[model samples]
Each structure stands twice: as C-alpha cells, then as structure tokens.
Target chain A: MMKRSAIAFSAITATMATAGVVQATTLEDVKAKGFVQCGVSQGLPGFSNFDDKGNWTGVDVDVCRAVAAAVFGDATKVKYTPLSAKERFTALQSGEIDVLSRNTTWTQTRDTALGLNFTGVNYYDGQGFMVRKDLGVKSALELSGAAVCTNTGTTTELNLADYFRANSMDYKVVAFEKADEVVAAYDAGRCDVYTTDQSGLYAQRIKLKEPDAHMVLPEVISKEPLGPVTRHGDDEWFDIVKWTLNCMLNSEEMGVTSANVGDMAGSDNPGIKRLLGSEGDAGKNLGLDPGWCEAIVTQVGNYGESFAANLGPETPLKIERGLNALWTQGGIQYAPPIR
Target chain B: MSTNHDISTAPAKPPIWNDPVYRGIFFQVLVLGAVVLFGLYIFNNTAENLERQGIASGFGFMNTTAGFGIITHLVEYTEESSYGRAFLVGLLNTLLVSAVGVVLATLIGLLVGIARLSKNLLVSGIATVYIEVIRNIPLLLQIFFWYFAVLRSVPAPKNSIALLDTFFLNNRGLYSPAPMPQPGFMWIVIALIVAIVGIIIMRNWAHKRQERTGQPFHTFYVSLAILIGLPALAAIITGLPLAWEYPVLKGFNFQGGLVMIPEFVALLLALSIYTGAFIAEIVRAGILSVSHGQTEAASALGLRNNITLRLVVLPQALRVIIPPLTSQYLNLVKNSSLAAAIAYPELVSIFAGTVLNQTGQAVEVILITMGVYLTISLTISLFMNWYNKKMALVER
Candidate 1:
C-alpha cells in the first residue's frame, strides 16, 4: 500500500511541475480560446471606463478591439479584465491577459526588466496638478507645502515626489490604491492639490462632486508616453499587437476612416492598397490573415476616430487632440509606413 | 509437562507487513518522503516558471532607489532612500498601529468586561450592547466609517480647529508640538531610566516587607514622586534641554511639528474598538469560569468588596483570560494588513502593493512580507506563553 501511494504521489507532483513549464504561445492560445483577453484600468473616463449598460468604450478599449479584429476579424471577440495600477503588469506577465491596453506609462525599467514590451505610444501625456479654483494656485511651482493626493503604485506618485524635491518645496502625499478613493480624498479637502497625468486630471475631474471648481495647472512635470503592452519572449504575438496599433495610426494618416476603409481598399495609391492588404504581404509577415489591417480599420476605426468618439471636444472630457494629432497635422503621432 | 512448557516457550516471528509497529514506521517514512518530494517539486516549478516568463527574481531590487514618498514614516526616509528602507518604514508603521491597538484594546476590554457583571442594570446593559454592536459589524466597514464619514467631515487646514494655540486638528491630520532635544537631553533621559530602576527595587522591597510585617507601604505614590521628581530635577539642572516646535500655518498646510495623519487615526480607532469587543467577551468568559465559591469565600474572610475582587478573584480569573487573550492580540496584528485598503502605509500597503508593482517582483516581495508577519506573530506567541506560565495556578 505504501509503495503504491508513493508512486501515485510522485505522478501528481510531476504533472503539476510540468504544467507551468509550457512555452509562450500566446497567439496560438488566443486563437484556440477564440478571444483576446485584454487588461484595462478599473475605470478611467475617456480611457477605459464602462457605461451603465456594461459596455466599455474608450480610447484604450479601442486598442484591444483593434487587436481582436486583426486576430479574429471580429471586433467584439475580446474580453476585458479591469485591473488596478498595481495588478496590471502582473496580470499580463502571468498570461492572465493576452494584451494590456491600459493607459500604462512606458518607462525604461519596465520595458527592460519587467519582461514586458511596449507596443507603441497611444497617447502622449505629462504629469500635471489640479487644484481647487479658490486656492488661487496658477502654476505647480507656486504650490509649495501643499498636501498632494494621487493614486499609489504609479508613476504619478514618483513624479509628484521628484517635482517637489527638485523645487526645494516640502509636501505631504496622501496616496490611495484606487483612483476613486483618491478622488474622494481630494474632494473631502484631505489634500490641497491633486496630481496625475494631465489627461488623467481631466478624466478624474468629472468624478469630483463639483467638477467645475477644480482646474488643471499649466505646468507639465514629466513626460508620460502611455501605450499598450504585451508579454516579452513572444515575438509573433508582440508583432501582432504592435502592428495593430501601427495600422490604426497609419490608417488615420491616410485619411481612411472606418466609413471609407472599404472604398480605400481598391484605391490606385500603392501605399493605400498595400496598407489595406491588396498589394503587399504585410499581414502575412505578422502571421495574420491578408485582410488584418482592413479588418482593424473597418471594425474598430482608426486612431483618430476612436479618439474623437471617446475623448474629443464633443465628449464630456472635452480633450483636444493636440499631441495625439497625426504628424502631417503638426503633432508627434507619426507611424512607420506600411510598405 | 516439561515438553508442553518448552513448546509454549518457543516464540514465533510475525511477517514485517503483519507487525503493527513496523507498519506504522513504514507508513510514516512514506508520508514524509512524499511531502519532501512535493515541496521540492513546487520550488523547482516556481523557479522554472519565473525564468521561463523572463520576470526577474531575487532580493537585489531592495537596493534600488524607491523614488516615492510615504505619508507616515517613523524613521528618517526620503525619495532617494532604498527600497529596503521603504520596507523598514512600512514595517515600523505597522508595528506602531498594532502596539497601540493592543494596549487600548486590553484597557477597554477589561473595563467593559467588569461592567457587564455589575449589579447595576444600566451599566451591564450598556456593556453588553457595546460588545454586540461593535463585534458584529465588519472591521473594514468600520474603518471606512471612521475615515470617510467621521474624520473627513472635520474642517480643512485653513480653518483648522485650534487647541491651546499649539495643537491643531484638521481634515489633513492632527498637528502637535514636537520636542527638539539639545545637547544635555541625554542627562534627563538617564535620570528617567534611573528613576524607573529605583521604582522596581522599591516595589520588590515593599512586597517583602508587607509579607513579613503584615502592613502595606504606599509604594505607588512614592514611585510616582521619584519618576517625576528625578526628571524634573535633571531638567532644571540642565536648564531645560528640550525646545518645543509648534506647528504653524505656512503656504498651504502646517509647517513644522509632529503630525498624526488621519489614516493612522482611522485605522487605529477601528482596530482598537473592533478587537476590544472580542477581548471583552473573552474577559467575561474568564471571570465567569471562576466558581462562585471563591467570591463567597473571600467575603467570608471579611475582605472588602474591591479588595476581594482584585486580589482574590482576578488572580484566578486571569488564568482563564490569558490564553484566549493572546489569540485576540495575534488576530489584531494580522488584521492590521487591512490598512492597505485605506492606504495607511503599512507593510502590506507600501511594500507589497507599491514596491511589488514598481519592481514587478511579486514573488520576492510577498515572501518577505509573509515572513515578517510570521516572525511578529511568533514573537507575540512566545511572550504570551511566558506570561501565561507566570499566571498559571500553582498547586501546593
């Protein structure tokens, strides 16, 4: 009896050990699973917030949709796992998500040491401060000795500390783990100023009790290039996510909206035809179908369309596409050519 | 008859499998070997998986600069401090809240427990209601109530509620005067230590004298006088080697002084009150476990009411109270991890939450945090066991 049980125990241990040793095949895994698992923020307006009807609509959400469209030719073939700032990276690194489309800042250490790859910059943001209008604070430098509130486990907290120390000013930080708690703490006057990405400042402002009473300061402290991320060591899957974002940017620069992508597929311009998969093997090189770029543009829309629908002047956040505009329009959002 | 005796005396050996003792030993060895193999498998699997995922592993990340600010730190820390220092800061904050919570819980528990047995109906009723109400609610909700509902409603820094023109209370925190020690402050501290030592010796002498002469000396008042007098004399001789720095209103908030952030207050209040309710129940059970005969015997001996309760009944009741009370203390220490939910900068909040996120080294950070909590819990258990041994009944 003892010998038999021992043999069984060894078998169980061997199987358990081998279970975790499977090689990284995220693209194949996603294909077999029939949907791409995307990680996003818990709730950041104009970035990754869900509506009352349980439908998520945001600029970051569109990235995941584009990847899903490129992979499955179906934009809705995606599942989102809402994560906090602390849980986002671990979720992607552990294979819990195929891609992390959260508004995560791209930093050197994260790209090199964290075993993750940043696909491309989706938004160019900078750390900014927001204060009550009655505080009479015009610039971030003027707000010395202020109690600052921000979310923990993010670049915002580090940026706030660096900005104060460099300016020879003393400050108190009241950081919370969740964005909602930070908003509540700031609204309760627990802090004198709320600091985060300028876009985040605008996004979180709407959550305040009196959104109009708060104003974002003019100074930008740190460069925050926000983008989507995927696990490293999987070049095939990485290329798919990277080129999916590139497809959106390239399509926008070519003036191909979701409304006009079908007609542009047959255009005489070789650049447009190759981008739409009618003239070159761009899609095959990434191990995707021939019409992957076309699928992304038609189903999820280009970068400009997603930005306009989710975060443009017509939306509640009313964010202008200044740094996010195409390079031809004098912004820095230039993508590599499709050819 | 001799042949029958010789035949019976010859013993027969059983097979190894049929021998109960050998079977037990064999099975035990098998189980131990299996457990060892399982543990080895898990360790190897984790190492392989971490390597396969390309996520860095090890404690080297602790040497890197933390580059962040913590709100409540007991020791000197800065943005340039190492992550190891950040861990220490977080550990100290956790220790502070847990230590204060344990003391306050014991005091409140003792008071409420005795009150529940009081003859006065109102006092017992109130105590009973307090235990039922506080212990039944979830601790996290209580924390939220204290933080958001109670402290958040306080006035802001601009209109801080001033006390004695030195201490202030506002939504940000409670600011008070901080003592800045000068060169001769060491002499005053030495004086205080000497006074404490003197009090301990006097108490020992007083206990012996009372036993021999059957007359008690007033040791409490004498000890109190020495404790204060020695410190005061040293301060006068040293020309007062301490200066008080009061908090003053500056640009946006209070400038200098000691401050207790609201997060600490809310967490401490919630932990103390919640644990107090459980301790109160344990105390009541302990007191009731002592038979009624002991109380009646004390009364028959003509002891006063308060004296009989304190000297006779309490010593017996404590034997029953301590073991369970130790468990409550352990629970409070472990529950302090909930401070993460409210951003109290405790070990789990700042170290495991923020540091783990920043470095992406979840395995190492979580292991270190768990190890710290284990060490703290074991220390508390060791101390409590020693205390329990002292209070145990000694039979003649």
Candidate 2:
C-alpha cells in the first residue's frame, strides 16, 4: 500500500515538474519569514553543535548568525535545522533552508554539478588519519593494508582511497553512516585507522574513551575548504552570504574587534568607513542594508573571534588557526578589499 | 395521453445527475481530475523550486565519474566508474543479499516450523520460545546488536583467530580461502547439469514402473546418488583442478582471500534470522491448515510417513502458504535496505546514501532506487502468483 502511494506520488510530481519556472529568491524569503533557515550538521564539536544550555554554537553556526545579522540586523533571528550528511544538500537545494552552514566541503562537483555556491571558507581543513599511538604507526605512510574506518557520506572516504591508491598501498575500508558510529568502531578496535578531516579528527578524538591514546598522523592528504553553501542562481542572496563572511574576515584584517567596531567606525580609515556603510553603496548593491557589514561585525565579531570562541586552543577541540589565519599573518585566508 | 408521453420521454431520464450510472461516472471523473490537478500543483511547485534554486533537473549526472570505492562488489568496479555503473553495483549487491537471505530464511523457517509441531515437549517449547523472542525484537536493533556488540568485540586483525590455517576471523571480518576455478570447472558444471537431467529421467521411469507393477522404487536415493556421485566423479576425472587463495596476515590485516566484512555478515544474519522467525510461524500455520484427514487418508492409501508428507500434505499446504509467503519475501527484500545502517554498500547505502550526498540529485537518485525496489517486488509477486496457480488443487 505504501509502495503504491509512493509510485502515484512520484508520477504526479514528475508531471508537475515539467517546464515550470520556480524563481526562488532566498533573500526575499528570509525577509518575509523574518528568520533565516540555516541548515547545520547533526552535531560536530566546534563546527555545529549544541552548547550546555542547548543553544547552537560553533564556527559554522556562527556563520549563519553572521548572515542573519547582515540580513535582519539580528544575529539570533535564525532557525537551525540539524541535518545528517546525506540530507544536507537536498535540504538546501529544495529551498528547505535559506543557507547551509553545515561545515560542508566546497568541491568542484558540488559547486557546479549540484547547483550550490559555496560562499567562503569558514574552516580550512584536510583529510588526515588518526590511529592508536600504541600501533607504532607514526606516519600515514605506514598504514598500508590497514583496516580504516570512516563516515560513508563524506569526501574523506574518497580521499582516503585516492591517497592510498596514489601511493600504491592496499587498504580496507569500514565505513559507517554516522560520525559517532565511525568513532565507536574505531574505539572498539574494529579498524586500525580512523580517517576524516583534520579538524574532525581533533573533534572526534576528544570523544574517544582515552583521548591521549590516539594520535593524528602528520599527513594532509586533500584540501577541504569547509564553508556555507547557498542555492546557485540567487546571486543576490549569494552575495549576502558571501559578503557576510568576508565582512568578518575584512574586519579581522583591519583589527576591528566586536568590542571596538563602533569606535573604529568613527575612525579615519576609508576602508572601515566603506565596510561599515559610512562611505559607500557596497551593501546596498547586494540588496541589503547599508549597515549590513556593521551588523555582522558588531553582532558576531570578526572571523578570528568566532574561531577563537569555538575552535581555538582554549576549546576542547583545541584546533589552532593554521591555514585559517589571514594571508598577511602567513595564512591563505584572504578576503577581497571592501573598497 | 399524459402517461403515454411520460413513457415515451423515458421518465424524463431522471436528469443525468440523478441517474446512477451517470452519477458514478461523474464521480470517478471528478476524482481523477482532482488527483491530476493536485499532482500538477506539486510538480509545478517542485519545478519552480528547482528552477529558483538553479538545481538541474535530469538524469544526466549518471554519466559522471563516481570517484569512490566500494568495499565488496560482486562485479568488477572501479573508482573511475560512472555513477550508472556504481548504481548497478549497488543494485546487484542488494539483490545478492536478498536472494541469499531468502533461501537461508526459508530453510531455517521450515525446520523450526516442523520442530514447533514435534511430539517432544522440549523441542516444541524451545521452538516456540525462539519464535516469540526473535519475532518481538526490532530488526534494526538486532542488526545493531550483532554489528556493535557482538562483532565489534572480536579480536583485531593483528590477533585474528586462525581456524585450521585456512580461515581467519577478526573484528574486521571472517576471511576464508577463495576458490580459484581451473579450466576443468566448466566440465564439472556440465556434469552437474547432466546429472539433473538423468535424475528427472530416472524419476519418470520409476513412476511409470510403479503404476504398471504396483511396486515402489527409491527415487530419492537414486536421484541423490546421481547428483552427488556425478559431481565427485567429474572432479576426480578432472584431477580436482582448483587452487585456494588462503588469507595470510601481512602487516596490519589479512590479504589474499575472500573476506566477508563484518557489516555484511551482521546485516545478512540479522535480516535472515529475524525474517526466519516470522516465516517459521507462517510455515507452522500453513502446515496446520492442511487438515489431519489428508494425512490419515494418505496413510490409508498405504503410503509411508515421509511419502505421505512429500506427496500429500506439502503440496496442499503450499497453496495456503504462498500469498502470505510472497508478502514475507517482499518484506525481506525491503528489510535488506537496513544494510545502510550497517554500511554494507547495498543499494540504499551506496547509491542512495553516498551517491545522493555526492551528486545532490535527491529526486533522481530516490526515484531510481524506488523504481529498482518496485521492479524487484513486482517481479517476485508475479513469479509467486504463477507458482501459486500451478500448485492450486486441480478440480474436474
């Protein structure tokens, strides 16, 4: 009976989808709804996870808040939908969420093929392996013929295979759907190695029964530019999301912390003036308020602050800002100039 | 003259709306129109949503490279294969597991069902407890229990338990020697086919002899010898031409063998065992539905106990069993999608779960997956319907 109905439903949907023009403007939707629908991960420490009081907090979560601030001048005016890895893309594509800020890796296939535009990198990550220190495996090169555990719906598995195959190493994979399952299997010694993004390795390592017993190998296999994603065609909404993160980065580069954003707004810095809407029409051109960047910087602080708050050395994950640091600070995290 | 006019006008046809046949046709047309309108509305909404989001709506993505590896595929597959190929691999894997599970579950179910009706009190009681215990627990939990609790506790690959220096068991999986077929394997297959044909001929001849002379022949023993003895004789004549690729520990894990991943083992075990319990109850009911008089009548015809069962009860009982049994087969096939939970690389896990995530073509991927399952289910039902018709009692 269920199957019969499902078939009938699909047939109807198929007919209805023919040549119909559905023009989706996420900016308009968010404005009309009074809140941005943000798609987030089910839970990933320091990326998108709940706090002690059940409030969502993470670098990825903060990206959505920044977008919300840019759009509505209110950082808290956003509702999060926790999505599994498999459901995130569809949720975004189907317009179920205005923006997907779920630590999704920006890839060529996703950006072009899946009709998604990655706004900007919130976290610079790479595929890395984690193994027990007692295994006498100091490097990833020693992991030939190892049974590796990883999450199924992730690029980590593909990267693992690529890295191994390129090096002509034979290995076995034991993949799970959920991150916690992979961690559990790794913990239970079901596999010799656990592989994922380096940040995820640090995050999940803390969940292990004995955190110090495992060591992350010193090899970065693939570049993972984790960022928020939006629908491809809405250039206006795309600019809003993209510039929201850029505002944070540009603020950090200009040394304008959240506490001193107001003071710096009055400064003689022409770049700051333009970014804060004191001088130009950059924000207005993107269909947002003139003070859009100001709201982002004032409410969510700069990118460094968001990073420090969620994933800095003080946090449980204790991930350092390596490639995530500004280009001037010997890192590749550079945003285009506001002027 | 007024009564004649009323009759000539067909009682004014009661108006078309008041006519029963017209009303029925009108209602059906209304319902059909409403359904089509509703369908158009949803499709238009989805199309607008896709167009608005700039998501491409089509099956063109199937041609793109999959760029991933499947752990165990029956067919040759590579990371460089197209999404279409990957989908085929997933489909085949799903069918393979379902087919194997169906056969195993039927065997176990039949045995348990027979045991449940045994004269021995302990045997029947144990069978009842087994049925009740397994039937009540959810299959997903059973899969989890086997995967997480039982399988995960096994020793790691470094300390794999070696059985007879041929098989290796570890947390990763059970690894045994894989048979490498030699050139003579074809002849052995041919020999088995010939033996089957020979058995059929033998059975026909025995039946005719019995009818003519009122004498019985042990067709079962003769058939069994032909089947087993022919294969053995072929293997001997062919010098037993086969090599074994035994699993050997190299560095961190075993290599060079047929490795059955623990996830698949757990999923198959869970699906088969769980479905088997329900099947057992169905079998018991089916057997009981065959009246006691049938058995008594067969015995009165001087047929022995085994012959009575094989010739009388089973064929009749099958007709009562088939409809529900068809549903169970469908249930098992659908349940095999639970392989996703265990990451066994079946249709749901690979093509639907991972490929959907990678491609982000949810509608297309889901449609294809649904179509595959629907096709499988419809085919099974059609086959079972034919079998049921054939097995039904023939009446003059």
Candidate 3:
C-alpha cells in the first residue's frame, strides 16, 4: 500500500515537472526575486562569516556580491544562504540556491560529475595538520601512529590517508563531521592531532580559547584549491559568473579600484578601457551591456580590494597574499585580455 | 496451484472491460507503461544533452587512474590507482564507520535508555536530559560541536594526556595499544568460537530440560564458565602465548597503538547520541507496553527484580522493541552519510563527491551509492525481523 502510494506520488511529481509547472532555470527566478540566492559558509572568518552587525563578509562572500553587482548593479543584491560542505552541492543541484560561494574546494568530480561549473579559483589551499607547538614535531612524517583528528567525508580525509601511506606512516585516524568538533575533541585532549586545509586550520584556530598554543605544520600534504561553483548547463549564467571573477582579477591587474574606478573609466589605457567598458564590445560578446564589467568593478571593487577587506593582513584573518597576487607580481592571479 | 487458478478464473468470467481482476491488471500495465515511457524520455533527453556537449557516457573510466590525492586510505592507493580502487577504499571506510558507530551507539543507547527508567531519580533525570539535548539538535550540529568545539581544544602530541601507561590522548585522536598478533591468536579465536557453540547448545538443553522436567539450569553462569574457561584452557595449553604491542610516548606522538581520530569520535558521538534518543523512546514504549501486572506477579512470586526483568519483562519487551529499534539502527547507519559534512569519507564523500568528480560518471556513481545504501537497509531490516520473530511469544 505504501509502495503504491509512493509510486503514484512520484508519477504525479514527474507529470508536474514534465508539464513545465516548475521552470528549470533558477537563475531567472533569482533575478526575478531581485537578488542572487548564494550559498556561503556559516562562519569561516575571512573566507565567509557574519560580521559585527550580522552582515556577511569574507573573500568568498564577495564573489556573490560581485556576481550581483554585475547582474543587478548592487553589491548587496544577494540573499546569503550559509551551507555546510555536504549540503552546498545538493542545494545548488536541487535549485535551493543559485550559486555556491562557500569555502568550497574545486575538484574534478564536483565540477564534472556533480554537474557543477566552477567559476574560478578564489583561494588556493592545501591539506595540512596542526598540533601543539610543544609537540616539537617538525614534519608530518613524525605523525606515525599518532591519533590524527580529521573531518570525515571530505577530500581532506582521503588526502590524510594518502599522505600517511605515501610517507609509510602507520597512524590511527579520529574522524569527525565538523571542523568545530575536531577542535573540541582536540581541546578535550581526545585526539593528538587535527588535520584540515591550512586556511581552515587558521580560521578555526582563532575561535580556540588559547589559539597561541597550537601550530599548523609547515608541510602542506595535498593541494586544496578552493573556489566558487555554479550548476552546469547554463552557459550564459556560467559566463556571467566566470567573467565576474575575471573582471575582478583584470580590474586589479589594470590598476582599477573601488575609489578610482569612476575616474579611470575615461582613462586612455586600452586594456583598462576595454575592461571598464569604456572601449570595445567585450560585454556585448558575453551577451551583456558594455556597462556590466564597470558595474562589477565600481560596485564590488577589484579583487585586491575584496581580498584586503576580507582576508588580507589588514583583517582579523591576516592571511598573506602568498599566491593570490597578480601574475606580474609573481603571484597566480591572472585573467585573459578583455579583447 | 488450484486456488490460484480458481482465483484467476473467479474474476475473469465477466466482460474484460468490467472484470475487476482484468481492470487491476490493466491499471498496473498502464502505470508500468507510463513509468517506462517517462524513464525512457528522461534517459533520451539526458543522452542528447550529453551528446550535444560531446561528453561520452559509460563506466569505462572506472579503470582510469585517479589524479586526486587522498588524505588516508586503508589499502594502497596513489594518484595512479584506478578510480575503482579509490571507490572500493571509500566504501570500506563507510562500512568501517557504520560498523563502529553501530556497536558503540547500541552500547551507549541501551545503557542510557535503561537508566532513564531507573529507580533513582538522579539517574533517570540525567538519562532523560541526555536524550532530550541530543534529540532536539540536528545531528550535523552535534557533529560540529564534537569536531570543532571539543576536539580542537586538546593539547599537542608531546603534551598528550596519558591514559594508563600505554594510551595517550592529544588533539589528534585516542591512541591505545594495538595488539600485535602472535602465533597463538588463531588458537585463542578457535577456542572462543567453540565456547560460543557450546553455550548455544547448553542454552537449548537448559530450555528443554526446564520444559520437560521443570528443572531450571543457570544458563548465564554455565555460559560464562564455558566462554572464559575454554579460552583460558586453550591459552594455557598453547603456552600462554600473548604479547601487548602497547602504544608508547614515541618521539612526538604515541607509537604502536590503534588510534581513533577525533573526527571519527565526533561523528560517532553525534551519530550515537542523536540516534540513541529515538531508540530510548522506542525502548520506553516497548517496556511500558508490557502490562504492569506481569512485573507485579513476578515480584509476588519472590523473583528478584533483576531476575524478573531478565526472565519475564525483558523477553516480552524485546518482542515489541526489536523491530522499531532495528529501524533506528538503520537510520543511524544511513545518517553516517553526514560523515561527508566533516570529511569522514563515507560513501557520499569518497565515492559520490570524490570519485564521481574525478571520473565524471555521475549516474553510475549515484546509482552505486543508492544501491549500496538500499542493500544495507534491507539487510539490517531482514536480520532484525528474524530476531524479532524469534523473541515473539508463542501463545497457544
């Protein structure tokens, strides 16, 4: 009887879906709602978190605002839906949110298999372990037979295992489901080590009562390039997001700033002219007005401004621009020419 | 066979259009046809979409090397290992957490549930509070509480909290002595199995003797003696061969112990505490559903409270409890999927999240995950149902 009812319900649901009762393009619905419904992190400090007045801030959060600035010309034109790692993908796939801009790592499977389009790398991270400084452990190699704490169901878990086996270390693993619990178990002296991305380890460390006592190990075991992601099959929307990031990177490269964007829009530099929509039909080619990139730059500021505001040395996160700097400056940040 | 024929014939005599049996069959056929048609349509559309994008579909990529790095794995794997191997390792990890979580949850749950009904108000209240606090919060939140707030506070490896001389706890995980197997371990295992078989036979004999001659044997004491005595005798005969590979305070961390990571701890604790709440309610209902008169009569017969519970109340209560409790257990096993939220590398994390991304076979990956979970749920239900039937009273 239950099975029969379930089948009927499913059939009705399929019929409704097939009959176009629900539009598949949530991107349009989001625009109609006057805001991009972006899923972000609950609170990872600089990556994504709430501020003093409960306003969301962070490098990842800025990505959402940038998209909104490009789409709606208002940086604040977005509804933030804070999501954990597990719920983020499903929420995007299910159309519960428009784009996932959490501190999510961009991987092959999440990009291709989960039908997600990663806009671009926002933060480059790597899996590293943290332990108390008094442990005097210099390398992860000394972690053999250690009770290593790591979060379950993540690339970190797999990376932890691979790192250990590759180094021929025989360690015991303590797996948890949240970053907070890993810290708690560590705080209660339950586990001997904690493992996560270097950035997360830093973000989580600040919340600890005595943050100074622990130290993140120097060796980053695995690469964890975190980025923003969108659903697949919407090329127009994907391009909009991708170029939003590109525009930010290009804005910084072209010496544009939130303070100077308006004045420099009439500048003579051709690359800047094209990027700020003062010259060339670059935005037209991408199916948007010539002013789209200008709106993104003026409203959302450049990538450097966003970075410094959220995670740079000025903020509480105090993250250095190790690899996030411009390509000409020996950093990885580079965007193709607007032409 | 004759009855089936008669049943078929009984409803077939009327016109095919008005026949109830034929109508049922026709409706079923229509529903089945619609399902197939819908399924085919979706399949066709997806295929065309993929083809338009020039994305080939197949599980042929299973053997392809996965370039992604994994943090930890039980078996050997590298970036060069096949995706299939990576998936298998992931499945093992999932099973590993579920198996461990199940055992621990049951132990803690049974204790707390019974404590809630204890004569002591303090104990009952504590148990009640435990259930209430864990039950109301989302399991994910609980897991986060354990992982971040709890484990992150531990001292580093060198300043580890020593438990006994051999075990140590630090921010990492629980490190205890891992028994390095010796030659006599097999004999010990065999002796333990023999003891179990003997106990089962002894229990049957005790039951039969009680039924036939009204003679009751103390099955517990006899089983305990057999279980311990046989293992001891075997060990002694094998020269009492045993060695403890105790974890020691090595250079920076403990060495030679079976370590349980903090992440696994948070997952287990959250999973157990969360599911145990529902189990407690199930147990309470099962216990309360048994008439009070049964307990009162057992007391009237001069049976001790423990004996009364063991012999009368519990046996009946289990009949009501087992089926529902099994579902709770299954729910727990499924909820372990949340291990991904914290990166526990259960099915969703390792296979669906990791492997599918690397391989790009979304359908194959998702189907496998769904199938694995369904199989696990079915097996657990079947086992519990069998146990429930066995415990059920045979009233004449």
Highest DockQ: give the candidate number: 1
lDDT of 2 by residue, B228-343 (tens): 99989999999988889999889998888898888877888888888899889888998899999999998889999888878888888898888998998999999999888777
Q: Report the error of model 2 at residue B211, Å.
A: 3.5
Which runs in model 1 stand beyond 4 Å of their true positions? A1-20, B1-23
Candidate 2 to truth, TM:
0.90
Scored against the true structure, residue B287 in model 2 reaches a CA lDDT of 89
Candidate topping TM-score: 1
Give the per-residue lDDT digits (tens) of candidate 1, residues B1-396: 999999988877689899989999999999999999999999888887778767899899999999999987999999999999999999999999999999999999999999999999999999999999999999999988889975567898889999999999998899999999999999999999999999999999999999999899999899999999999999999999899999999989998899999999999999999999999999899889989999899999999999988998889999999999999999999999998877799999999988998899988999999999999999999999999999999889
The interface RMSD value for candidate 2 stands at: 1.5
- Which regions of candidate 2 are displaced past 4 Å? A1-24, A262-268, B1-53, B119-121, B295-312
Two-way TM-score contest, 1 vs 2, winner? 1
The window of 10 residues in a row where model 3 chain A has the poorest summed lDDT is A18-27
lDDT of 3 by residue, B1-396 (tens): 999988877744678899889999999999999999999988987776555433447778788876555445778876678888878778777788788878777778777878888999999999999889888898877877777754557777677888667788876667787766688779988999999999999899999999999988989898999999999999889977777777777654566667776667778878877887888878777788889999999999999988997888878999888988898889988898887766565667777876654455566788888999999899889998888888889999
Give lDDT: candidate 2, residue B16: 78
The global Cα lDDT (0 to 1) of model 1 is 0.92
Error of 3 at A217 (Å): 5.5
- Model 2: colliding residue pairs: A16-B43, A22-B48, A24-B52
